[model samples]
Target: MLKSILLFSLICLTLLTSKAQSVQWASKVMSFSSEYSDPLLGKEYRAIHILGRPSKYPKFSATPSAWQSLTPDNPGGEFIIVSFDTAKVVKQVAIFENFGAGSITRVDALDENNKLYLLKEFNAGYAQANGQITRIRLANPTSFKVKSIKITMNSLRVSGYSQLDAVVISDGDSPIEDRIKLEVDPNAYLVKENLGTAINSKFNEICPVVSPDGKKLYFTRWKHPDNLGANKNQDIWVSNLKDKKQWEKATLFPAPINNEENNAVCGISPNGKTMLLNNVYGKDGQMEKGVSLSFLLRTGEWSFPKPIRIQNFKNKSEYSEYTLAPNGKVLLMTTEMKDSYGGKDIYVSFLKSDDTWTEPKNIGAAVNTGESESTPFIAPDGQTMYFSSSGHVGYGNNDIFLTRRLDDSWLNWSIPENVGPVVNTNQWDGYFTVSAQGDYAYFSSVENSMGAEDIYRIKIPEKVKPQTLVQVSGQVINQLSKLAIPAKILVKSRVSSDTMQIDYDPYLGDFSFMWPTKKPFYMEIRAKGFVTRRENFDFRDQAKYFESVQLLGLVPIEMNKQYKVPNLSFIQSKSEISKESYPALDEIVLILQENEGLHLLVEGHTDNQGDWDENLKLSLERANQVKSYLISKGISVNRIDTKGWGGTKPLNTSTLEEKRRLNRRVEFSFFVVQ
Candidate 1:
C-alpha cells in the first residue's frame, strides 16, 4: 500500500508541473474591482496584488510593505475581480494564502463575453497554511480563453476578513519565457543624424546649450588636447553658426572661462552674455565643486567667474545640473535632494526681489520617477521643459521627456510625454535644447558619432515643439547726447503681470528682453537726470517667431516739456480705458510718486475720427480717467490738472489710419509749483 501511494503522489506532481508550463499568463492588468478593502491596504492592492510576485515575509506586516496581504472589510459574501489587458487561456490558478486563508470559499473565471465559469469550490476540509501556494486545477476546463478572474469568500466561523498575498495564473498557449519578452511597436519611427566634424571631435562632447538667438552653441568636451588644463579634464568649447546648417570649427572658450581645472558649461543666458559653468578645482589638497557665473564684458571678454552661493544648496550632491529660463528669473535643476521621489529629480527655483534664490521645490511625480532624472532645459517660451529620465516608461535606458507648466505654481505640471524614438534610443539620451524658433533641437548622442559623444540637430516634431517666444532687443540712449545711456529697463506684462528688471550694458547700451506669450507689454527706461521713458508692445497679431526692435531715447526732465505716453489705448468713442492701457497708466502713477513736489498736467488728445464735439468730450473724460487713476494710486488730486486738446492738437496731420492712430495719445508735463 505504501509503494502504491508513493507512485500515485509522484504521478500527480508530474501532471501539475506539466499543466503549469503549458499556459501563458497575462502581464498587464486592465481593470480591478473589489467589494470592500481594508483601510490599511487600499483597493488597488486588494484587487491587483495577485499580479506581482509573492513577498518573502508572511508573518510580519508594515505600512507600504509588500508582504502585507489584501483584506476585505467584511468577510461574508465578499468578491475580488481583476481583468487583464489581453485574454489568455488560463489552465491553472494558484493563490498564496498567508493570512485569513479559510475565508476564501470559491473561485470563478470569466471569458471575453463576460460569461462566468465555475473553477473550484472549497469546503471546511481544506487546510490553510502560512505562506503556502494552493494550486487549483479546473475539473472541466473551459473551451474559451479567460480574460478575468473573480474570487468569492464567505465565512461564518471566522469573523476576520479574507486575506490574500498573491495570485498566479498560467495561460494555455505561450510559455513563461515568451511572455516575459517586451514587444516594441514596429510602426515607431525615430531618425537621428550626426552634427558633423565642425562641431564634434574624436573626444567626448556633451551638455549642449544653444543660445536664445540660436546662433551660438556651447558644450563641454573631455580629455581633449586643446583643453587649457594639463590634467586632461573637461573644458568649455563654443561653435558659431557659419551658415544655415553649418557650424564653425569648435574652439575652447577664452581663458578664465575654461581654466586648467575641470570645467563644464552648465547653461548660457538667453542673451548669450551670462554663462553658468561647473568647475572642479582643488584647494588645500581637497577638490571643491561649485557652479560659477561668468558674464560677457562689453569688450568681448568674459569676466572672472564668481561662484554662486545658493542658500540651502550646500552639499555637491544636492545639485547636479541646471538651466536658466530666457528671462533669468526661473532656474530648472536636477538634484538628489531629500524630497526627491527617487534617484535624481528635477526642481525649480525662482529669483527673489533681493536677487537671492527661493527654496527649491520638487517638480512633482508627473515628471519624476524612482529612477534618475537629469539635464533639464527650459525653452525660451518658459512653459515647456525637456529633461532626461530613467524612471518614466520610455524606449530605453534614459529617454528624453517633455512637459509643460500647467499653472503659475511651479509644482503643477502636465503628464510628461516621451520625445519618441527618433531622439531616444536603448542607450542613454538627454541634455536636449531647442532653438529660438522651436524648429530644431540640439542634443548630444553616442550613436553614429565622431566621438564618444557628439552634438546633433534634428527638426523638432510639431506635437512637441515648444511655444514660440518673441525676443525684443534694442538700445537705450540719451535723446540730447545721442549716445548710449546706462539705464534700467523694467518690463511688465499687462495680462500676466510678470515683471523683470534688466540693466543695459553700461558700455554698449544694448538690452534684450523675452516675451513668452502674445500679450501687451509695458516697458520703462530710467536713467539718472533723465525723464523716465515708457513704451508699449501690442502683440495681438504678432508673428509666432520674430524679434521686435525697439529703440528708446530718454529725454531730460524739464519744466513745460511734454512726453507722449506711448501705449494708452481707450475704448472707441468712450473714456473707458482698455486693458492694455494699465501698464502705461501704472508707470504714470510711479512717475507721480517719484516727483512728489512736482505739479503735473494730464492732457488727452484724440484723432479726427469722430465729430469734433464728441472728440472733445471723450478727450476730457479720458484725462479725468487718468486723474482718477492717479488719485486711486494715492496721489493728491490738487497737484494734477486735466486738459482735452481733442482733434485740435493732432501729432500727425496725415489722413491714413496708422497716422491717425499715432495722433491719439496722452501727454504729461511736469513742473515745480512753488
Candidate 2:
C-alpha cells in the first residue's frame, strides 16, 4: 500500500511541474530594429521590455515597458525576433499591442531548430485605433510545437509610433488572465559584452582608466609575458579609440613608468598630461610602496614617475588602490589602517600648497562598510562618487556603488546605491571609471574575458550619469616672446572656494580642465618671466550648457600693447553694463590687485556705423564706466586712465554689421606705477 501511494504521489508531482512549465513567455529578445538604447525609455519601443507577462495594456505607455520603432526611424526594414525559454506544444500565442496598433503585417513561428515553416499573413493592413488590452491571438491548438516567433511591423501603416508590450504563449487556447502569476526577473539587463581582443589578451587586464577625451584608454595587465614584472606583477597598458569607435591594439609602457615591480594607473588628469601611479619610482627604475606621478614631458614621452609625499601615509594591506579627483585637489585611497572600520575603507587626502598631500581621513561609515571597500572614483562633477565593496547589499561578491556628497563635508554622503545588476555581477566588478561625458562606464570583468580578466564598457542611464561638464582648453602665451609658456595654472571654484594647480604643457603651451560648475570659475595663469593673467568663466545664467567646449587664446600682458577685455557689454552699443562683463572686469581687477605695482588704462572703441563725435563720446563714457567700477572694487582712481578710440579705430574694414560690431570693444593696458 505504501509503494502504491508513493507512485501516485510521483505522478502528481510530474503533472504539476509540467503544468507550471506550460505557460511560457518570450524569454529572450534575439533581434530588434530601432530599439531604445536606454532600457528605461522607448516604452513598448524597446524590444527587450516584452520578456515577461503582458503589462495589462498601456494606459499611459511611458509608465510601463513597451517597444516602439522609430518612425521613418530605420528606412529599409523593421522587425523583432523573440525566443522562449522552453519549447512546448502551443494552444495559442498572443501579441499585445497597446498603443498605435495594426503595424503587424506578418508573424512566423519557428521550431526547436529555428526552422520557420508556419506563419500567418495579413492583407494590406492599416493602423487601427489604440485599444485597451488589444490581444491578437494567432495559431491556436496548432499541430506542432514552437520555439520562437518573428514579428514584422510597419510604422507607415500606423500614423504614429507603434508599441508592443508583451508576447505571451500558453499551452491551452483560453485567454491568459490579467493576474496570472509570472516568474520574477530582477536583474534583467545582464548584457555582458567583451571589450574585444584589442584590449583583452590571454592574460588578465584590470584597473581600467579612460581619459576624459574618451579617445585614450589605460588599463592594468597582469600575468602576461610582455609585462615588465612578467606574470608576477601588473603593468599599465594603453589603447586609443580609433576610427569606427573601436579601441586600437593595446601597447605596454616601458621602463620609466613600469618597472620590475607592480605598476598601475590610479588616476589621469583631464589634460592627459599627468598620471598618478601605484608605486613610487626610483631614479634607477627601482620601485617602492608609495604613490607617484608621471607627467607628459615636452618630448611627448612620459616622465619618470616621481613620488608625491603624503603626511603620515601608511597602508596595512599589501593590496591598495588610489584615485586622483579631476580637480587635482583631492586624492582617494582604499587601504587598511589601524583606524579602518573593517578590512578596508575609503579615505581622502587633500593636495597642499607644498606639492604634497595631507593625511588620509576616513570617508565615514555611510559609504565604507564594515567589509572591504576598494577602487574609489570621484566623477568630474565631484559630487558623485563611485566605489566597490563586498559589504554593501549587491548582486555580486564585490559590486560598485554610487553616492553623492551632501555638503562641504565629504563625510556626509547619501546612502550608497548599487549601480545596477548588469554593471555589477555575480563575480567581482570593480576598477570602474568613466569619461567626462559620463555616458559609458568602463570596468574590468573576469567572466567571458579573453584571458583571466578583460576591460569592458557599457552605456549607462542618464539618471546615474555624472552631471554634464564643459571641457575648457587654452594656451599660455608669453607677453614678449609670443611663444608658448609652461606655467602653473591656479584653478578655483568661487562657490566651493576649492583651489588646485595644474601644469601647462610647455611644448604646446596647452592646458585643459573640466568645468563642472554652474557659477564663477577662475584660472590664474602664471609662468616664469611673465605677468600673471586671471580668467573667469561665469556660468551662473547659462546653466543649460552640457558637454560643451570653450577655447581660450593667449594671456595678453605686454607693457605698451592692448588686450581686448572681451566684455560683451558693448555688443549692443549700449553703455549699460551686462552681468557678463562683471566676471571679465573682476578678472582684471584680480590681476591688478595681485600685482600692487601695476597701474591700469581702460580704453573703449565703437563701430563706424555711428557719427564719429557721438561714437567717441560713447566710447569714453564706457571707459569711464569701467574705471568707476574698478574704483568701486577698491582700485585707486589716481592710478587709472581712460581713453576712447571710437569709430576712427575700427578693428575690421568690412562694412558687414557683424564685422563692424567687433570695433565696439574695451581694452586694458598695464604698466608699473612708478
After superposition, the stretches of candidate 1 with alpha carbons farther than 4 Å from their true spots are 1-190, 279-287, 314-319, 478-482, 517-520, 527-534, 538-544, 562-582, 593-597, 601-668
Which tens-of-lDDT digit does each residue in 1-674 have in candidate 1? 00000111001122223444543223334443342334322222333334343322223121121112234344435566656556777767876565556656788888999899888888864745533455676554568888877777664434454445445567443222232222344443335667778878899989998888888888898998888756867788898987667789888887766667667787777677888777533333223555667888878898877666555863325448887776777877787666554456788888777877777787875676545678998887777899987544355666787888887677887767667767876678888999777878988777767869888888887768887678888888788888887888888887885677888865743677667657688788877657777777877686577888877898877887887776786546767777777767776676667767777898998888879988998888888988888888898999899999888998788988866777767888888887
Alpha-carbon RMSD, each predicted model: 12.6, 19.3
For all predicted structures, in order, the TM-scores are 0.66, 0.58
Q: Model 1, residue 187: what's the lDDT?
A: 44
Number of the predicted model whose TM-score against the real structure is largest? 1
User: Model 2: how far is 468 from its true place, Å?
Assistant: 1.7
Off by over 4 Å in 2: 1-190, 229-232, 476-506, 517-674
lDDT per prediction? 0.68, 0.70
**How big is the positional error of residue 357 in model 1, measured in Å on the Cα after superposition?**
0.6
Q: Clashing pairs in model 2? A: 43-66, 44-66, 44-67, 44-68, 45-66, 45-67, 45-68, 46-67
lDDT of 2 by residue, 512-608 (tens): 7777756478887765434556677776654432443433334545676787785544765687677777877876777777667778889988888
